[model samples]
Target: MRCEEGPLSEVYDRLRAEIVDGTLAPGAALVETTLAERYGTSRTPVREALRRLQQDGLVERADRGMRVRTRSPEEILEIYEARIALEATAAAGAAQRRSDFDLVRISRAQKTMTATPASDPAAMAESNRAVHEAIWAASHNGTIVDLLTRLNNHLTRYPWTTLSMPGRWEEAIVEHAEIIDAIEKRDSDRAYELAREHMTKARELRLRIYGDDATA
Candidate 1:
């Protein structure tokens, strides 16, 4: 059966994208009237969008209306730790269970991420997310996909992307390629090792961005 979506879904998608790309930053006010005016729609869709955002952990109710959810530095670090553990497991599963279609989709996502034209930071961030999600889907495990998606949505609360750091994007391209190769070869043990190493190095890079305060 075909799914039917209305204005509410469109509004939700736009708002969610903005939130993920840091356009609607953490703690930014989300008044229905203002959003409706901006989107040139009515309050109904705005309200609906806010509701979905709350469900997605991107926003929270406030006394005035709602606002983008914010996380403390410590909370963000803890969340990354969770992501590292979960994603490594997912990668191992993908190596074991991935189909031909899954491999093709992941390769396409990798190309999108490493586009020769060099996309802007926001586009690059979304591309990075796409690759990770492709791997998650390739695992053929619904539970891990759901867990990783939620963690990633929370991750977007950070204003800066680890991929934007100098040399980081190039480094990630090589790392991702290795991960994909391991999965393609159906080397589950190697995939698990590469996944942990990838995330651990990424965490270290991100911590460097946060500097002394986060590393502590």
Candidate 2:
């Protein structure tokens, strides 16, 4: 069946992208009328988008109405911990079961991402997500992939502009290369450890950005 991208879905996707990329800062209000006007749609679609955002944990209902959700340092750490568990397991499974076609696809995606200029944060984020999803799919575990997909949506809610910083993008490319190598070697343990370590570094970067400040 061909999935429909209705007005509501369009608004949802746009708002979600903005939220993920930090265009919509944490704690910023999402006024339905303003969004409706901006998107050239009715308030109905905007409301629907807000509802979907809430479901995705990107936005929350506040006393003044809808506001972008903010991640506390503790919460960010917890989320990364959860990611390590889920993604490490998935990477291990992928190492065990990945097909040659899967490896090729993953290699291509990573190459495209690494080739992209570091100055393009938007493109980098898109390609980074693509490579990760490809690896997740290689595992051939539907349930695990679905869970990671949902978690990733929540994870993106936090501003991760660190990837745009000097050297970090290169670091990420190298880390991805290591992950691909481990999977290609069919070393499940190594793949799992690399995945966990990669996320741990990501968590550290986020902590540096958000800091221990509770108000941040």
Candidate 3:
């Protein structure tokens, strides 16, 4: 079958989507020739895409060859801890620095997420990313924003199917609303606390759904 739009760009997008959606599970081997055939392209573009994934920490060169990076349970916990630190700091900064326009944007995104049906996991995930990215941008720290963007590449490996579980989407909406409320009030400490709490809870829920194997 022919690939979607954007030849080179589609190579990257397709591979990234597969990795993020868990089609290429963590620790799965990624043979260059197989990928090239699958995508109807030469190995050149496949190699380039793999390199980009490596730089993003989603893939790594292992003893066998290039494979999706696997995270141990301990490693997952560590990444979540780091997320707590970085996200809390970002939320604090955002609360202190966000403009009215930024607040409006965040509110709009939150509203969209809330209005989305619980059955629409893909839309929810995309909207969730947008809200978080808006907060990161409001912080006005390019360094932290860049770092978090990279970190999310790794985080995307985990299945977000948990968010679609019964009642979980509602819980997520409530959690996100609390976060937006804190940001709107400009309570930096509350905002930081809420952001950290939200991530911690998400990590726990994810672990519960997929067991230890889901982490990487």
Candidate 4:
């Protein structure tokens, strides 16, 4: 049986999309009445949608209203530390368990990431996500994938991409290629080390670019 989407679900999806894509922006006000007017719905559905988003950790209570959640520089660093551990594990698992089909998917995602125009940081960032997601899928670990997905949502709320920094895109391309090579060789240890190094480099660049922003 097919389940039909309700008004609340519709509002939730739209609002979540906006929040994740940086359309609403971190710490942007989310007023029930304003959102209701924008979505052409009553405040009832919008309120429920806000509640769900809050549960998802995408919305937070401000002094007098709801706003998009913001991560301080310290929090962002902590998230990266968690990602570094989990993603390295995923890369090692992929090297050990990936099938031919999984390799094919990963290769395709890498090619897409490399081919994306560097001038478009947004597109490059999206392509980069595809490569990471393909590698995660190759790991065959549902739990790792789910946790990374949730963490990535928080990271993407930023309007800027680390790939936009000078030379970062090129450097990332090389790092990704090396990681793929390690996985293709079925060198689990090598893959794990490479993945950790790759994420650590990214973490460094993120701090270099956004460290000045106290609320980043």
Candidate 5:
């Protein structure tokens, strides 16, 4: 994929990254004038960036103004349902089609994830993206990969990782290994089953962690 470019693009990319990484948070007021000043630019680019973000589902119209989108538990769960469907199918395809090159990339990402402690949500989230993206790439389906990329970006806007829950890191490590093993052995059914189960577990853990925030 072509990486985004230029100053305006940089501003947009950084803002979007901060939103996902929680520097800019849900319901946080985003003033184009203020952001333009902060980024040493005019409000025009900031305005455009916010428009782009809104289109991408990271920003939303609010009574106060445009703000980072806050999602309900139901909405979040629905997003995960879509993700599970896409990724499970991708994983199944990956199992049947992954090349040695794909395995190498997947292994590296899996190792990085395992090496990170569960207490470190940031590191785990990054590695988690890598592992999942590798599987998506392995599937060799451009449309599904593009859709999943957009979905995952929106998913990361939530502030915490399911891995930070007690014992969740260990569980993820085991689960990821099983999925990778299934692909290695060309077991598409097992890969699909494992991937679907993985997403279901993630959605449950996230809802548990969100607690009152989920409902509110």
Candidate 6:
């Protein structure tokens, strides 16, 4: 959770936030000198930040310079597929290993998500991410948490949230409830199945939305 402290960290944090929030849209150019001037620092920090972002898969080398990555639908689907596998494993681990404190945190996160207004898709999406983060933490596997965090960053780059789709908010809440129930009961197998099913539904909805958007 602790990032390096310094000018480079500042630049990286600012840029990453902008990209995730869609201020720096996909395919947008990332010019080093321009960012350096904007951040009121020399190009050194900007250059290093850009390099780190590239390694994080948030930026890519463009014909002229680096730019925010623009993922194709297929690429997005692949990321979701990876998430499905990892999330299921994390859920199983949580069921077997979660402490009372961990369960409380997970329940709180889910409650926050449920309380968020469906009309506010962005807030709902953020709360939804929080729920998963708690679940991942309950798993007590740093490696899985790290990988899922990276994949989530990539997914959040998209401006839209699947939670915005009609009925999806309710559906996701129900699905999350089932997963929570399994975890609370210490049923690892059931937790794994529920988590896999949840992510699979999300992937399906995402694909359907992409197809609809393409046609639209």
The C-alpha lDDT values of all candidates are 0.84, 0.85, 0.82, 0.88, 0.87, 0.89
**Deviation from native of the Cα of residue 189 in model 6, angstroms:** 1.0
Q: Compose the digit string of candidate 4's lDDT tens values, residues 60-147.
A: 9999889999867786798899999989999999999999999999999999998999999779989999999999999999999999
* Model 2 regions more than 4 Å off: 1-6, 21-24, 31-40, 212-216
Q: Over the full model, what C-alpha lDDT does candidate 5 score relative to the true structure? A: 0.87
* The candidate that achieves the highest lDDT relative to the unseen native structure: 6
Best by TM-score: 6
TM-score result, candidate 2 = 0.83
Q: Per-residue lDDT tens digits of candidate 2, residues 1-216?
A: 212333777889888988877789889999987887777777887888898889888899889989999878887777788888888988899999999999999999999998898888879888888888989999999998988887877878765656875688999999999999999999999999999998788878878877634456
At residue 141, candidate 2 shows an lDDT of: 94
| Candidate 3 lDDT, 129-190, residue by residue in tens | 88888889888899889888987877777655557767888887898888777877889999
TM-score for every candidate vs. truth? 0.79, 0.83, 0.87, 0.87, 0.88, 0.91
Which should have the higher lDDT, number 1 or number 6?
Answer: 6
Per-residue lDDT for 1-216 in model 6, tens only?
322333788989999999988788889999987887777777888889999988788999999999999967897788998999999999999999999999999999999999999989779989999999999999999999999998886776666678898999999999999999999999999999999999998888888877787789
Weakest 10 consecutive residues of candidate 5 by summed lDDT: 1-10
Q: State which candidate, 2 or 3, has the greater lDDT.
A: 2
Give lDDT for model 3. 0.82
Candidates sorted on lDDT, descending = 6, 4, 5, 2, 1, 3
Model 5 residue 117 distance off true place after TM-score fit, in angstroms:
2.7
* Runs off by more than 4 Å, candidate 1: 1-6, 17-24, 33-42, 63-65, 115-119, 210-216
What ranges in model 3 sit over 4 Å off? Answer: 1-7, 212-216
